[model samples]
Target: MTTTAQPQTGRAEGLASRYSTFMSRHASLMPTFAALAILILLFVGAQIYFGNFITPRNLSALLLDNSYLLILAVGMTFVILTGGIDLSVGSVMAFTGILCARLLSEGFPAIVTIPVMIIGGGAVGLMVGVLVQYFEVQPFIASLAGLFLARGLAFVVSLESIKVEDPIVLWFGSTRFRLGEWYISPTGILALLVVAIAAIVLQWTRFGRTIYAVGGSEQSARLMGLHVARTKIIAYVISGVCAGLAGLALTAYSGAGYPLYGVGTELDAIAAVVIGGTLLTGGRGYVLGSLVGVLVYGAIQTVISFMGAEQSWTRIIIGILLLVFIVVQRVIVARSDRRR
Candidate 1:
């Protein structure tokens, strides 16, 4: 009787332990949920505090204005999820945008120019990933070099803002579909499509699991037969391609490409990813968190404008929040590693 009782008790404790572990591991997602709640509250408060805030026109402007940021955030989420960073994204956007504009001006047509830009961006990102993963180069230093190279390419492509003369291309960036009082936009739709695809890829595929494994522990992932280097490299390439497409959209929305655009945007994308609950030290987080992060960022920008504050405050606010979350993530990850 004593032995039977002991076995039953041991099984109960094992079940409880598994439950606890699952809950704790998933608790990292709580911050992202909190961020989303706060963002909604802020948006509502802005509507109440500022009479003009809720107009369909103003809301549309907000969504359309930040489409590129939205796209880039998705890519950044992947990089952060894998315990890495890519600072050259902004410059890469500039490079792709200018290249697309140049092709459009030279009569390459919309279909060819757009894909070329996106592919070029991915290629550049792949090169950077190769250096970081195989050549053992630090991400910061390698991306910094990439930044300069991309900027140089942008300059070489166009000394002036080049406009796309293709009507279809312009419409893709500017046209809106009406839905009664609330309108849908090309840019917003594109952003949503990209997010959905990224979510599915991250959550459902073998490649996605490899990414998580690689991020969770590089050495362990390698021993377990994961393609850790290839996974990281692909993450970077995805980011680059997304940023490139973003730049292409920017050109359409603005009707021109200038080399100086997207200079500080990569930082904004990184901050949004972190704020949305991604661990900077890596091994945890999701693409949906990035969507929430983009909304939070846009809400903050909107609120700051409503408050009549300097635009620079956006950077300060993001920087402070980023520091706080990063420290918390480091502490959590460190403790978990010790337990393991």
Candidate 2:
């Protein structure tokens, strides 16, 4: 009996050691894994409680409803991964949407209007990046200025909602490809494409590697012959372009654009990115994790709606989860430091 008990104890110790070692080696992924687990559990529990919760139609709806937010999260992932923030994204989205609507209303071709909207947003991002990198302004302050500029421009475009009537624009939201009960709209497909491209860029490209290096330590990156300023500026540009795409998605989804659209949405993007396992302090994160984060956020909203609770409850729940993940991140970082 003593010999048998000794072997079991040894096995338990070995398993614990292996887990600890693995965690130390991949500390950055812990939060992402946690977010994914939470998403799964939330889905399973909701399905158990609400008999129709696990249907394919409901799953597709989740992607459809959150496609714009998912696009914004992809860009936010890039900005945040580099230890920077872009407060202007929400306003930029609103600005571009209204701009697109106005252009389409004024007889501008969809082909022309789309590129104008995208370039407009990228221009704003470039301004913010220049302020941060060249003028030595803090990212927060630079982006705040950008936020005001974009919002003011949005209002200047139009105070009232502008309906989008372009065939191409409407096609993105109205058309759905169905597989039995499951379906995906063009907007959803676009969001997925953005995520896939971003994941590949971050995982395989030299610029992507430079982004990580800069986030990890700008000075070290500079010493390593990396182009820190270029990377930072390009990151902001990418974020801005993403914001523009999000605007297009949102406008398509709603069939209208208002100057007031996307208010406080930057916070949502940041929250989703952080909740997905990206450290607020920068340097470690995944584009795929951002997708999971968006799903988790959508799941929470769905659960709250099913409970017949107030919409504000979703914010409360997300806030609590965000805090929990932040604490988890700190612990993981500390453990990694100790290991090093």
Candidate 3:
């Protein structure tokens, strides 16, 4: 009997050891897991508090409203992953919107105007990246300069809001597909597509791996023969392109391009990224996490509206959530370091 008990105990210990090893191996994912839990809780709480919060129409509206921000968050995700910030994204978004409006008003077709806006946004990011990588400028300083340049350019383009009267642009903005009782706008569709593409690029591509490598340690990345400069530049380019796309989305959503649009928008994007479980110092995050973060944001706003509180409360709630997430991230990072 004793010998039989001993064999069973050994087997139990072996199973426990394997489970512990698996947990340790994937420990970095803890923050993302925690974020997911928080999102679910907030979502459920909103539905419970607001009788109509789970309605399909309202949900669709939430997606439509946040589509642009989601796109911006995707771009910002890449830059942040590289342990850098892009303060220019918000300004770039405004510039792109103004540029699109100017182009469309000047009789440029959607096909031409759309691509130009995106490329223009990418160009701004390219400039910032070049300043950071080639000129050895710090990302913060370079992006700050870019922010001012983009805003100045937007004001130069137009002092007042430019209404988009283009038939194609208006049609794109108005068109929607009905799913059951819910309608999804083209902007929402594009947002989902961008998230899917970004997820794949970040998870599977060589460039994506290089991004992580560079973020982990630029010196180590160079020692391993990774093109650190190019990777960094490309991240900014991605961010710029995303900002441009976001601007276009916003233009469609609101049917106008205001030079002052997206002021402080960078902070929102950063908040989303941070809440999504991405480390500000870089080297650990998921594109899917960012998407969930966006949803959490939308859900919070919906909750506030359902409660009939002031709209300003939305910012206050977001600030509190952002603070909590940042604290969680710090703890996760410290624990990870300790494990190492």
Candidate 4:
């Protein structure tokens, strides 16, 4: 009897150890699940509050309205995973939109204008990365400079909103596919494609692993012979390019470009990233999580709109959620430290 009891106790201890290890390994995923849970709850609440909020038409509208934001969040995820921030993404979006609008107004084809916007945005991102990696500039300051430069450039291009009269641009903005009772926009497809590609790059590629390593610890990453500077810089470039693409999506959605279109957008992206479970300190997060975060954001706005509440409620709710996620992250970091 004593021998049997000892074996059972040992087995229980072994199981407990395995459970702890598993939890430790995947703890970063908690915030993502939390975000997902919040999304579901919000959706349910919206349905309860507004009766028809769960219909296909409303769902499609949510995707269409927030496509640009989803794209921006994907790029922001890459930067945040490296424990860096890109404040310029919002400004880049505005700059790209304004530039593309001007070019289109000048009779440039969509084909030409699109690539130019992407390249230009990438250039700005590269500049920010170079400043941060080579000049020893802080990420915030470097990105802030980028923000100012991009915003200033947008104003320089035009101080007023430029209407996009190009046929292709208008077609993109107005065209929608009927799926039974729901309508889907081309811009929404673009946003989903960006999310899928980002997910693959971050999860499967060598560059993606290097990004995680750098974010984990720059000193350790260098010791492991990773291209820390290149990875970090590329992250910013990806962000910039995404912002540019988002600008195109915005142009398609609105049929015009305003220099102030993406004002405070960077903050929104960061909030989505953090609320999605990406650590502000860097290293452990998923791009899919960012997608869910975007949905949550869109859901809040949808709920507010359906409820006929003032738009300010969206920001207020998001602020409360952001604060909650930040506290959760601190708790996660504390647990990780305790484990180490």
Candidate 5:
């Protein structure tokens, strides 16, 4: 028994050593890996516990139901990657949706209304970026000001909910493409497209590389001749545009736009981005990881619904998971520093 235990201990030590070396070399990816692992485990466990959890219809519903959140997550990923926060995204989304609904009700064409909504959101993002970059305002304070401004403007548009009747606006959410039991709505497809485009840009574009460099070290990025100001500003704009798109998706999904529609949604977006393994301090994360994070959030909600539990339980579980991931990130960061 003693001899057998010694061999087992040796193997365990060897495995641990290998893990440490891998982690030291690839510390940035650890959070993403952990998030992916948790997502897989959650899905597999839920599927075993609830026979229908992994069905095609359910899976499709997952994407469809959370499509708006997914869009928000993509934008949030960009902002967070630059080590900045955008608290105004939720409010911007609400403002755009309400504005869109108002315009459509006034007989505006979909083409006209869509651009107005997207550009409107981008404009608000530009404000935040200018405040942060030029005025040297902290991102949190600038975005909070943006949040208030957008929300106030939303109420100014209309305090009451407005129903969306335009065919083009409605079509994205209502139409579903079926592949057997699995179906995806146009909104879901659009969200996926956004993710794909963002991923490509981040991985292959000069702007994306600049974003990473800025997050890693702004001073260094500046010294290296990267356009830190432009990159940061563009990141906020992307986030705002994404929020606008999310608003559009939500409007289509619900067939109505309310000033209160996106309340607390910024928190949800931030949570998903953080859970997706994007560091709060920035410079290390992925667009695909954000997608996985949204899926995990949706999965938890679905599982809770299946169990007939209250919705708050979902928040509790997510909070615990968030705390765990943050600790993991801290450990990885510390280890990397030690290795350096």
Candidate 6:
């Protein structure tokens, strides 16, 4: 017991220190933890109050319902990290969904239609990125134009909801994977998998680091020789692809594509991101935290419904909460600046 530690143990100790440092720097994660706790409590409360809230059937329903939102949030997290915004995400998703439905209506196989939708979305994103990065346009303004354009495309394609009729594709939306004592919908599992992959990409990759660097300070990032323009452009491309896939998820979930499907989804996604502790100014956030934020948001919606509030109350509460978070962020940023 009195023997000194082995040299190999020093490396382990160092690794632990590094991890602790990372965690401490990201102490804002407390909000996510608190959000998780609240959601768990709400789930239990829902079980008591609603009787049907925590059933396996209900669990599956919640997952299926929110899958596309999770997908859209994944892309939004990337865009927000660069201190930029993508208001067009929801509209873009609507556009792509209509495109997929139209293609399937034309007898295009799912295999062919999927890539076509995604590639088309990517092209839209590429053009937006070029406008923002190469042409030096403000992101908000550029993305606003994109939103209008995508909405116009949706209207031009069809002003009404179109049904999807592919039996094979329908299965993806309606199927469930069963295990002993429980089952989960395919859409739910897909959303979870997408979130996990996004977390890894944002947390461990050079590209991820570059995103943070750009968000933290563009001039400093440029001085560090980061490919800022390329990275920024790629971020939107990823966002666009996510939107397209989200459209597919929405279609599969609902069994149809509606021109009005994603109206205000950007606001919901933005609220989730801000609540997740992502700095509005950029450079500080976590993907896992964003997931927690999403769950928290969903829980709030669920809880409000349980409390018998009108649907309109949900929007009011969301707006108030967003304002509170913005004020808190401003104070924290100010204090941090002073300390620096």
lDDT (10s digit) by residue, model 1, range 291-336: 8888777877888988999988877877887787777677767777
- The whole-model lDDT of each prediction reads 0.85, 0.94, 0.89, 0.93, 0.92, 0.81
Give per-residue CA lDDT, model 3, range 119-157, as digits (tens).
Answer: 999999999999999998999999999999999999999
Span of 10 residues, lowest total lDDT, candidate 5:
331-340
Error of 6 at 295 (Å): 1.4
Between candidates 3 and 6, the one scoring higher on lDDT is 3
RMSD of 3: 2.6
TM-score winner between candidates 2 and 6: 2
**Can you write out model 6's per-residue Cα lDDT over 186-221, one digit (the tens) per residue?**
767877888888889888999999999999998999
Top candidate by TM-score: 2
List candidate 2 stretches off by more than 4 Å: 1-13
Top candidate on lDDT is 2
> Candidate 3: which stretches are off by over 4 Å?
1-22
- The RMSD of every model to the true structure, in order and in angstroms, is 5.4, 1.4, 2.6, 3.1, 2.7, 5.4
- Better candidate by lDDT, 4 or 5: 4
Superior candidate under lDDT, 1 versus 3: 3
For model 4, the stretches where C-alpha displacement exceeds 4 angstroms are 1-21
lDDT tens digits by residue: candidate 2, 1-340: 9999999999999999999888778889999999999999999999999988988988999999999999999998888888999999999999999999999999999999889889999999999999999999999999999999999999999999999999999999999999888999999999999999999999999999999999988999999999999999999999999999999999999999899999999999999999999998889999999999999999999999999999999999999999999999899778767867
Predicted structure 5: clash tally: 0
lDDT of 6: 0.81
Residue-by-residue lDDT tens digits, candidate 4, 26-57: 99998999999999999888788778889999
Which of the predicted structures, 4 or 6, would earn the higher lDDT when compared with the native?
A: 4
Backbone collision tally, model 2: 0
* Tens digits of per-residue lDDT for model 5, 16-112: 9999888777777877887889889988999899877899988899999999999999998999999999999999999999999999999999999
> lDDT (0-100) at residue 157 of candidate 1?
89
